[model samples]
Target: MDSNGVDEQEMKLVQGAAGYVLEDVPHLSDYILDLPTYPNPLQSNPAYSVVRQYFVDEDDTVPQKIVVHKDSPRGTHFRRAGPRQKVYFKPADVRACIVTCGGLCPGLNTVIREIVCGLHYMYGVTEVLGVNCGFSGFYSKNTVTLTPKDVSDIHKRGGTMLGTSRGGHDTSKIVDNIQDREINQVYIIGGDGTQKGASAIYKEIRRRGLKVAVAGIPKTIDNDIPVIDKSFGFDTAVEEAQRAINAAHVEATSVENGIGLVKLMGRYSGFIAMYATLASRDVDCCLIPESPFYLEGKGGLYEFIAKRLRENGHMVIVVAEGAGQDLVAESIEQQDASGNKLLKDVGLWMSLKIKEHFAKQRKMDITLKYIGTFCPLPNFNSSYLRFLKYECDWVHVSDPTYMIRAIPANASDNVYSTLLAQSAVHGAMAGYTGFISGLVNGRHTYIPFNRITEKQNKVVITDRMWARMLSSTNQPSFMNPPNGATEGAN
Candidate 1:
């Protein structure tokens, strides 16, 4: 404590800039002394000559938190990502390689394309290699030279043009290969675990006194990687889920006392499930990893389903794959190659539970009957087939094998991936190492690798965004008793 007991630490002032701290990224100059710089190609390129603001000032930064109080310190900031006036590596000296690790995401191809194009078009760098099948490819010699023409139409396709894998990170071998191939700039695209691997590679490179610049393009369809606003391909995953949600809605409404149960990919964070449920107004209940839900108790999912179905003819239930793990009985513990927990099929379990509960209770006597619209076919006799009334007390909708992460990036994700890729390319060219190209508070910035991979970001069940989603779905938070509304539910 200071003498005055003013608690100056609460102010959290930065050096020379009161209350503002720059979370600066590592540069080659930080480790390698007297690193020479070359003029940025954009300075003389006719394509960018007419643009007024072609270069980003070194002093420019973006705040991590935008909703701070008036009296609060400005909090932390990161260097804004873009082209700089001078770059550490010359065009002819740049030997870059791109690798995608972990699982497949929507915009992997888009990111690969932009990174190659950004280097080829923005700078005159010629040598770019695609490390196939992830980190293992580093030693496996599964590489192909990448050019703008090679990735020209790959963006229009689904999945990565360069294949990806999980848990092949051999730091010694990878760095050895990098040194062997004279690769100076490395672009790694992956999720939290993958970024951790990227961090390891960077540390090894730094330890060996190598001049390679390692840049990370964070990739997680789950949106669990912290510090970034949102990862690329998350939008496309959520959008692709709309089709499944719509299909469930149709099936549920079609059957008597129907319960369309859908499961989405969310092993840790519930962003995909939450947003999909919110977008799907048909959902009557949302279950996620962040929100603990019961099934057999007073405030259980069964009670909510009974109530919702009683009020409405049918109900749709959206659950993240990681939800209800505590309730599901799994005797064996398993982990994937990337060390992520293997989640059981919560959607199937939920469907079975709902069916058993309803069948045992025998409380519902649904005789759903609907008439099809009569229409006259061109050059054919008018005919209409009416759906017969069915008496199924309970039904379910499930297709757990359909995964959304492998699909092509939607328009929103494509643009976001392009920006992220360009930002990574820029940071690499500018000599930033051991950093992630991510969006913080809507502004793209360079984040240290450890800051991104140290922990996973999760959904805040108590936050207002969750409340908004709850309000949209009209679903119970599954937090309160059946006789009362959920506590603190918005």
Candidate 2:
């Protein structure tokens, strides 16, 4: 006999004699009739009850024919996903070129090296060329192809190994040369002026329907390239300035007699001067291009230094190379041999004014010390002076009189340069045309092609808010006073 409740696959029964049949039973949801009706065993106990049924039928069985619905969570209609695919270039097919124009920065070589290696090894790019003398090299057929081995040892080098030129780009000739040599791409490395040239070249290339890609790499110590965090060489320059200021501080302290005037490089922006002062913490007064001063004003640097000399006996001043000294010296302007007003050196002028004021008011002969040239590299015809021998009565310091044009760049700067180089390679491989590889938020990013337009090349000046913050009287409590004295104390 077979029980009708049993599934067909499991139906089976065994029968036995004597007019009685024993049948195999299927599992049932409830067996209440099998339990004692009154006073059922374990029913009185609250913990256990054989009469109570907890199991129920669930419709979870596998279907005979599975149907995958598109809207279900496990649907098969979702789009395929994978890692991002990068565009690559064949080594033989890529004929890339780079040019460096204008003043040299500390990390120009590092950017060049990374670009060359990234192209050749990672992107299968070959025929990397170096354009000598900037845009001029691109106009003629004098470009030099750089091999993987050419840039192997340039990781720690300072300036661009390919050389640099100030010549402007000749677009028609450049396009002609690119077409003639079958160059696929070009990278221009430089500051504002170089970017302007790059824009022209890109426009010309686009006009002719050339298949060449163009990219720019920002390399300026000024750190003035807008829309980017910072330029490559700025860190190295700031480090150099900090070291110089530290040395000046030590010399200034030991002598206890003379004022040292250190002039820093910042034709427009005072970022270098401000950062260097923050690093050294020994700068007494800093004159930046953003802030102009009058010699006889209430909060003038001259007056502040005079007051300091009367009390502290010596001072240290940091002046940007581009600060307006003419306005400061308007009261007593003098001319040189060529009939040009021999504008007093801001350092010397301030030093002289302080000395005169102290001698007249306090009746003391205060010694004056002037130490200029805050740039890492030597400037043209600038004489060096020893701190103890030339400026002070003490004589234990090193002979700072010798000029040093080249110094080892900072480690931080080298790291930044490497990043910038890698970024340039990435940008070029991605077919990013007419963009500069820049470092921002600690990552390598691009400054778009349009930001370097001719009209946007001007440097931004410090607004009233910045001027107030940097002002001696209105400075924040955390900022050290210009006299190297703590605020709210004496």
Say which candidate scores most in TM-score: 1
Instruction: Identify the runs in model 1 with alpha carbons over 4 angstroms from their true place.
Output: 1-14, 365-402, 480-490
Clashing pairs in 2: 91-124, 284-482
| Runs of candidate 2 exceeding 4 Å displacement | 1-84, 325-362, 373-408, 453-490
Between which residue pairs do clashes occur in model 1?
none
Mark the 10 consecutive residues where model 1 has the least summed lDDT.
Answer: 368-377
- C-alpha-based local distance difference test score of model 1: 0.80
TM-score of each model, paired residue for residue? 0.89, 0.66
Please write out the lDDT profile of model 2 over residues 1-490, one tens digit for every residue: 1232212312223333432221211111111123211211122334434534421112111111134455533211101111012333444577888888876787777778878876766555777889887778877566677877988877566666877777556678888888888887788888777887786776666555565667788766767666466777777777777666666666566554566666666655666776666666677776766665544445555566667656666666676665655444344555432232433344444444455555666655555555653221221123322322344333233222111113334677778776677666655554445556664444345455555443322233345434433553222222222443211100
